[model samples]
Target chain A: LAKTTQPISMDSYEGQEVNITCSHNNIATNDYITWYQQFPSQGPRFIIQGYKTKVTNEVASLFIPADRKSSTLSLPRVSLSDTAVYYCLVVPHSSASKIIFGSGTRLSIRP
Target chain B: GAGVSQSPRYKVAKRGQDVALRCDPISGHVSLFWYQQALGQGPEFLTYFQNEAQLDKSGLPSDRFFAERPEGSVSTLKIQRTQQEDSAVYLCASSLGAGQVNTEAFFGQGTRLTVV
Candidate 1:
């Protein structure tokens, strides 16, 4: 598994755009970058996933540079409900690979 | 039925006791996973099951921990001689296909275990 490093915590206000970056210097060629959001007392929800370039969904956008050494999760027009712990995981393309979640970046949304 | 479900949302156990946690994955899901999450920390992998086979169990913390997925639908995690360090949330997740695919894994609310 590739180890990921992210900010311990971040603060933002309502209606603002929040960008969280994750650094995975030793990412493997077969690894894929995935982002998950976990609210208090709940399971982590999949936010977005991208192998390279950019991938966008209704909720967020993932930008992977050409080197694929890092990725960024961009959330547009964030609200108070966006407050949660975000995890960046690099998983191998294997049938039985397990996910190892590290201490994620906690995003606190202020009113 | 609609999503992954876990039983005994909260459990309080005494040290040296045994406990069982159950997980019900989504219908037709081929991959099931178990994870342990401590307070203020990210979830750690415990085990993985592909259909009725236990593909991986390397993440099991100790010999006291055991997990089984009989018949491939429902699964149970058993811990013998539980200790205070065993107190944490046990989460279960299921995906429609193998991990090599682009499938998303859905997670249950998880069972919060407290060892006193």
Candidate 2:
């Protein structure tokens, strides 16, 4: 299992782009970086995932540098409804690998 | 057309009683997972099932927690002799299969368990 470290909280005004970085210094070769967003009373929703370089989706973009030890999740033009806890996970692809969730970054989008 | 669905969105159980939380994964999904999330904390993995076989349970806290997916479609997480410590939101998620590295998990509105 790979442990991830991220900021505890962040604040941004509406229309601002918020980027949360996660560090997984001991990431395994087979691990893939994934991010999820969780709103109150709801389960976490997948945002974006990347193996290396960059991956973009409708909701967010994931940027992974050459080293693969760190990744950033970018939320564009965030709105008040975008306020939620964001989790970064490093997961393997086989045998029902377990995902360990750290204390996620609490994102607050101001109006 | 359905995503994962958890039943009895809220469950209130007395201490020492047993409670069963159900999870219905998307039709034909081959992987199902159960997690426990406390208030103000991200979810912690509880168990994982591939098809009808439980492959990993290292994250389950204690012997009181058990989960089973009989036919590989619906899973049930049962907590025996529930304690106040067991009070937390129980979440279930399903994915295409355990083979793909980037398979996205679809999560259900978790079952909030309260032990009083």
Candidate 3:
């Protein structure tokens, strides 16, 4: 399992782009970087996933460097509803691999 | 149903009692997972099922916690002799294919278990 480290919390203004970075110094070769957003009283939802370079989706963008040790999640023009806890996970390419969630970064969007 | 559904959105159990949580995954999903989430922390994996076979259960905290997915659709997580430490939100998730794929796992709202 690959352990991820991220900021505990972050505050940003509305209509601004926010980028959250996660560090996985011991990432495995077969691991894929994935990001999820979780709100209070609800389960985490997938935002974006990538193996290397950059992957973009409607909700967020995931960028992974060649070293694969770290990744960044970018949210464009964040709104108040975008406030939630963001988790960065490194999942291996195995049939029965387990997903370990760390203490996620709480993102707060303000007006 | 449409997405992953967990019954009894909220549950309050007393100490020494047994509680059973239910999870109904998507119609054709192949992977189902159970997780325990504390108030200020991310979800911790409890168990996993690939169809009717339980492939991984190492994340279960103690012997009191048991989960089964008979017939390969719905799953039940039963905790015997519940303790106060067992009070947390139990989450259920399902994915279309096996864990090797990059598919997204759809999660339910979860059952908030409060042991008093």
Candidate 4:
């Protein structure tokens, strides 16, 4: 299992782009970077996932460096509703054993 | 249902009581997982099942916690002799399979368990 480290909390103004990075120094070769967002009283929703380079989706974008040791999740023009706890996970494609989550970054969007 | 569903969205149990949370996976999903989330912490993995077989359970905190997925669709997580530390949100998720593609897991709203 690859452990991820992210900021405990962040505050950003509305209409501003927010970028949160996650560090996985011991990431495995087969690991894929995945991000999820969780609102209060709800389960985590998938934001974006990527293996390397950049991957964009309707909600967020995931960027992974060539070394595969770090990844970033970017949300554009965020609104107050985007305020939630975001988690970054490194999952090995071939591993069926377990998937773990870090403390996660609590993003607060202020208007 | 259209997605994963968990029963008794909120449960309050007395200390030392036994509680059971149910999870109904999406139709035909092969991978089911359970996670426990504290107040301000990220979700911690509890157990996982591939079909009817429990492939991983090392994440279970103790023997008091047991999960079963009979028939490979619905799952139940039972915690006996619950303690105050067992208070948390129990989340259930299901995915198509553990393959590279479609590895994303669809999660249910989760069951909030409070032990008093």
Candidate 5:
């Protein structure tokens, strides 16, 4: 199992870019880094995922360095609606049985 | 439905009672997952099924918790002799493929369980 560590909370102004980083020191070779966003009373939504380097989607981008020990989720031009709990999950590609989540970073976008 | 659907969005059960939560995965989806999320906490893995076969259940906290996907599309999570600690939002997710790639997992609004 690969565990993730991230900031407890973050605050950013609207229209600004916000970045949340998660550390997974013991990630396995077959593991991949994925990020999810969750709003109040709703389930988590997939934001982005990457094995290494960068993965860009319509909503967010995921950057992974060569070490694969840490990954960053970048939200561009965030708005008040972007406020939510961001979860970083490191799951092994070999098995999807353990899609674990940490405390997650609570992102607050203000005006 | 468009995504994973959970029944009885809100459930209240007495202590020591038995309760069952239902999850209807997307049509043609091969993988289904169950998670438990506590207040102010992230979702925790509970169990996973790959086409009616329970491939992994290592995340289940106790023996009282049981889940089954009989027809490969509908899943039910049953909690026997529920406790206060069992109170949380149960989430269901479905993916188009197995756990071999970085595919997308669609989640539901989740079933909020309150054990009194």
Candidate 6:
């Protein structure tokens, strides 16, 4: 399992774009970068995922550089409801691999 | 299409009491996982089951914790002799495939366990 480092918290105003970066220096070749968002008392929801380059979806976009050592989760036009804890996970492409959830970045969107 | 679902959304137990948390995964999902999340912290893996077989349980915290998926659909996590430190949210998730990249997990509302 690869350990990930991210900011403990981040604050952004409504209508502004927020980008959270995660560092996984020991990321393996078969590892995929994925992001999840969790609100209070609710289950974590999948935001986006990518292996390399940029992958955009209706909810968010993931940008992975060529080295795959780091990835960025970009949330466009944030709102107060967008406030939640965002987790970045690197999971292997094998069957029944362990899923480790590290400390996530708490995103606070101010109105 | 229903996502994962858990029972007893909130559970309060006394010290030394036993508790059972249930989870119903999505229909036809091959992989189901159990996780424990402390207050203000991310979730930690507890165990995993592929169909009715428990393939991995290394993440289980202690011997007092046990989980089973006998029918391969509905699962239960049993905690014996609960302690105050056992307070946390127990989450259940299911995915279409057993491989990581092949499928993404769909989580349930989770059971909030409070030991007093």
Candidates' RMSD to native: 0.7, 1.0, 0.7, 1.1, 1.1, 0.9
Residue B85 lDDT in model 1?
Answer: 99
Model 6, residue A82: C-alpha shift (Å) = 0.7
**Location of the lowest summed lDDT over 10 successive residues in candidate 5 chain B:** B96-105
Tens-digit per-residue lDDT, B34-55, candidate 6: 9999999999999999999999
In what order do the candidates fall by lDDT, top score first? Answer: 1, 3, 6, 5, 2, 4
Q: After superposition, how far is residue B93 of candidate 2 from its true place, in Å?
A: 0.3
Q: How large is the interface RMSD of each prediction?
A: 1.1, 1.5, 1.0, 1.9, 1.5, 1.0
Q: Global CA lDDT of candidate 2, please?
A: 0.91
Query: Which of the CAPRI classes, incorrect, acceptable, medium or high, describes model 3?
Result: high
Each candidate's clash count: 0, 0, 0, 0, 0, 0
Off by over 4 Å in 1: none
- The CA lDDT at A23 in model 2 is 98
| Best-fitting candidate, scored by DockQ | 3
A1-111, model 3: which lDDT tens digit per residue? 889999999999999999999999999888998888999999999888889999998898888989999999999999999999999998888998778889999999999
Q: What does candidate 1's lDDT look like per residue over B16-73, in tens digits? A: 9999999999999999999999999999999999998999999999999999999999
Model 2 CAPRI rating: medium
Model no. 3, DockQ: 0.83
Which lDDT tens digits does candidate 3 get at residues B8-116?
Answer: 8999999999999999999999999999999999999999999999999999999999999999999999999999999999999999888845788999999999999
Chain A only TM-scores, each candidate in turn: 0.98, 0.97, 0.98, 0.96, 0.97, 0.98
Candidate 5: list runs displaced more than 4 Å: none
lDDT of 4 by residue, A6-70 (tens): 99999999999999999999998877888989999999987778899999988988888899889
Clashes of 5: 0
- Using TM-score as the yardstick, the better of models 3 and 6 is 3
Model 5 agreement with the true structure over A1-111: per-residue lDDT tens digits: 888999999999999999999999999998889898999999999888889999998999999999999999999999999999999998788654658889999999989
- In Å, residue A61's CA in model 2 sits off its true spot by 1.0
CAPRI docking class of candidate 5: medium
* Model 6: per-residue Cα lDDT at residue A107: 96
Give the runs in model 2 whose Cα sits over 4 Å from its true position.
Answer: none
Question: Candidate 3, which segments miss by more than 4 Å at Cα?
Answer: none
